[model samples]
Target chain A: MMMEKLTVYADRMSQPSRAVLLFCRLNAIDFEEIKVDISKRQHLSSEFREVNPLQKVPAIVHGNFNLSESHAIIVYLNSAFPGIAEHWRAKINSAMDWHHSNLRQGTVSYVINTVLGPATGRPLNPNAAAEAEKVLISSLSNLEDIWLNGDGRFLLGGSQPSIADLSMVCELMQLEVLDEKDRSRILSPYKKVLQWIEDTRAATNPHFEEVHNILYRAKKKFEQQRSRVAETGTEPSNKIGGHSKM
Target chain B: MMMEKLTVYADRMSQPSRAVLLFCRLNAIDFEEIKVDISKRQHLSSEFREVNPLQKVPAIVHGNFNLSESHAIIVYLNSAFPGIAEHWRAKINSAMDWHHSNLRQGTVSYVINTVLGPATGRPLNPNAAAEAEKVLISSLSNLEDIWLNGDGRFLLGGSQPSIADLSMVCELMQLEVLDEKDRSRILSPYKKVLQWIEDTRAATNPHFEEVHNILYRAKKKFEQQRSRVAETGTEPSNKIGGHSKM
Candidate 1:
């Protein structure tokens, strides 16, 4: 089959977007990346609204199918491109579906709502943040259980990397950036999960220079905010205290 | 084929659980309903945790497959019971997948975070509410566009209702109950959506009565809180909101 041109609407820092990017790379699906400027609120702009009114990242324009939602996009990719590895595709689908309701909304939302709120100087709603953290801890604990009990090194039964591994690793990476304590909590108990992340990274092509470029830009922004706080003689807003008892 | 017994862990007021009930009623999938007491937080109990450690409702245990997440459960139902209108199944699957990450999360979260919060005298986070409303409005607008422009009366092209209609109707109903003004907004422009709800109700069996019971129960709880606020100057401590917005 002739390769169709795929345009992925994404920001590299977004876990969902990373999931799609990694999926495309693994499947060897020829695609072009269109960075949606989430910082400038371009996603909500009229021009981009024409593309996705929902204004969320991880959208795709493939031929006649203009799809949003990372899970839908990945599913469409797997169904449309049949020549890719079957086991990997199935595993990715299962994990992506699981992540949508469980980890993404559950854990990732926790980090963004709680830790990232103070980081960005957004008014942190303590009640919502606490609820989010409760959900996040449960989700992370579940991930540990699944990783410990599951038959494969990755989430599903496969030796090669899948979209599941990609989606999960990105979310965990976000969690790591949010709180160093959380990184320890997630990794220390889940030995297989830690190993799996390393394995998946090694198995895939590390040519995410473009991905790193986006991350570097975000880091620069973070540093600027820190400097502003320092100059103002204000306590750093983003820092979280030690982990609380479950 | 002999029908597989399905056990649904649900509460009637929950939008997602209602979606499951609607699916079973439409597809003639026989299942026993196990209502979780949201008022008492029965979902958080350790026994229930084994079924879904996340402690959310609209989970299912069918044969050997134990699944959580409303979208996952609905998809599994469609897949397991192919007798439930195949064309409608595909359309419903696509629509549900789209809505899961978009409309469902956005609308449901907005309702809970904004309307329900103020009604319960909980500390209302206006920023979260505003952010939620932006997403909710866009989702509702897209829903209007799709229903108006799409190929069929229902979400997918079929005379009978599918899981998409079930999932959507439940979410819309939650939005409807949140506030009279918001309800008017939805009812005014979305005639087709209103029609879809009636059609879904009329086509399906009496299972919706159970759904109505749960909704009204929630409504009663909200009213009681209002009355209590009127009588005494203090707010209720254990105010249970609607669904998780998963």
Candidate 2:
């Protein structure tokens, strides 16, 4: 069977894009990965909008058809590939649905308001990060108690990691940039969740680390800036992270 | 064939619960409809948490298995019943994913803060709503220009309605609680969207109208109160919407 050609527009900086990119690489799916450079605001350009009128990252163009939203793109891929386990179909669907407004919201929005917004040149919104902490704790507790309590090593108790796990673990992994005290305050309470993250990472291996390299670099730069500010008497300029247009 | 019994925990006031309940009622799915009244804060109670720890409505119990999230529950039903149309599987899934932080967020939060909060005596956050309108406008424009552009009456250009139709239209119908001028200002610009709502309502028929009766009455009482205030020139002291604890 001839597999349909797919062109993926993605950025490593975003959580969902990392999940979609890692999935393709882990499965050895043939495709072109075009870096959208969200920090550069490439997603707002007219050409990208032609492919995805919503102008969001992690969109895919297949033949004449175009689809946006990372979860949607992954679901489309599941059918196109025909190799995903039958048992995973319904459970994975449910997980993605739950992930959308829960883990995705709790993790991504929390970090964006707290660390990313301030670290980047964008103005940080007050109290959102504080509110987000409550949501994150509640969400991670559910992930540990409800989703992971099943017999399998991954969510839905499956022996292998589903796309849902990849999607969620990627969202949680963004906390790596935050200083240890803050990161642990949020993540350390959930015992099963930490184990699940490691298991998911080991399962995805080289591709997992490969896709996350850019994020790791971003964290290092953030740390260096914090240290530099400590050495200097003056505050870091407002334009410190101007590249993060998103 | 013998069928397993199912139980659905829901609240009529919440948009997604209406979607899930209507799907069951329309398809003749055998299930117990348990109304966890949000006004009473029944969903937050410990008993309900045993069913769905996250404490949100539109959860379900099938034997010992439990699941929350309206989108997840409906998708699970599509497979468990196997009576849903084949064409709906992919498109409906995609629509639900796109809906989470987009249409659902834009419509529900905007109304909650702008209209429902004030009417209900809940503290309304100004910026959250001001921000939500921007998102709502962007989402509606896409629904008009892209999703509704198809030949079919509903999203995905389908001849008959899908669960996605049930979910999204339920969200837009919440605007019925707002006054005519406000509602018209937000809704009137999108001709196709207005038509799509009517088409969806017609397709779903009596059940759609029947399910939305609570919202209808809420709107009527709101109008009556406004009229009373006009005649007497005093604010209504009674909190009419106290039951809508959400």
Candidate 3:
């Protein structure tokens, strides 16, 4: 009998997509990956809409079960692959689960809404990037405090990594890739966070080395795209001065 | 054995705080609520800051386990009380946990950035409000599509309510309390969402009704506070204006 296949629809640059990829790798789950070209508006296409109407990446199609949202996918996968040589269930404990759903969500939003938008030329205002930096810094300070006070190992109290680690590490990695300034700011003051990154990378599967490589390449692509936009002197779609009424 | 005293530190008008209150009511979790006065800037007070340096509401103290962030609180309560005689876990699974996180977060940001500031007599750039509205409308559309496609009972697959329902409902309620016009435009088109609200209210524990009443009272108080700010004609906090950056 053929192994049950998990088909992940993802864009390598999306932090959530990378989280899913890392989850599959860590669990030794057999899956095929199909890249969704977010840059080309592939997610907006009708064919992709059938799979996930939200047009978001990090969706998984497992036979009849179609799923989106990286958190749900990670939880479902952990539950499905209970015997995959990892203490999967323990990772979804009270604190870590909450962290994944709340603090992580807050930080990621701050990064995306503030940092990524401005860096990519889709900011609501020119000053939006600086505002995001302030919020991001404040949130990072809170995270650092949590690490100092909490178990201080993996995001949860574990010798091994879990979903919480996967969720957070991916977001942090995405922030790092946004620009050298962001990377330096995040890594400089948060020394423990830097160590956490090393730990998570070491824990992740070697297959995901390809996924990591893809992020670096995507960052380069994003820079090139930004420069092209600058050269053409054309504003991006979501900018405040563009079609935005506000 | 003393029943575990879960003390909630909250400001009822806040969306996240309401989520925690609703969850406790839905699950019959015994807890005490300590209202933090947002009107007097109590959240920013050093006393409150010790509990949560981020100074956000929806923080909880259950014995030695203190936590902030509404989503985290719900997940923690659900897990901590697994025998609560409900399909809570399944509710989290089907409620578009991942999608709801993004949608609810975005909606709250929009409401805070656009409506709340203006309602409180803080000068809002009309252009900024309009831009925030556009993003908010897009998120609401996605939510409407999800409801149109899903089980149509609760947010998840259950005939009963879940954490997702609480989170989304609180956000909608926040928008409603902030700007009646904006709420009508955003919520009126989705019939199923309206039905979901009715269903959730009917299914929730009577204790939650009390909490809802408290929130209503708090909303009125918040409105008064806004009126006072307008009357005084003082400049709003920079943090309040910083939301648009997100």
lDDT of 1 by residue, B1-246 (tens): 236678999987678888887778767778899989765779999988887765788778887667777777766676677676654433344567667667777776777776566655456677777777777776767777764345666664456566667778788778655545666764567666777777777766486655666676666676676678779966655545633343
- Higher-scoring candidate on DockQ, 2 or 3: 2
Q: Worst 10-residue stretch by lDDT in candidate 1 chain B?
A: B85-94
- Candidate order by decreasing DockQ: 2, 3, 1
lDDT of each: 0.68, 0.83, 0.67
Point out where model 2 deviates above 4 Å. Answer: A233-246, B118-121, B227-246
What does each candidate score in C-alpha RMSD? 7.1, 3.5, 5.9
lDDT (Cα, 0-100) at B245 in candidate 3: 35
Write the residue-wise lDDT of candidate 2 on B53-90 in tens digits: 77889899887778878887887786788576655765
When 1 and 3 are scored with DockQ, the better candidate is: 3
Worst 10 residues of 3 chain A by lDDT: A88-97
- lDDT of model 1 at position A43: 85
Chain B alone vs. reference chain B, TM-score for every model: 0.81, 0.92, 0.77
Look at candidate 1 and tell me the lDDT of residue B146. 63
State which candidate has the highest TM-score: 2
True contact recovery of candidate 2: 0.51
Tell me which of candidates 2 and 3 scores higher on lDDT. Answer: 2
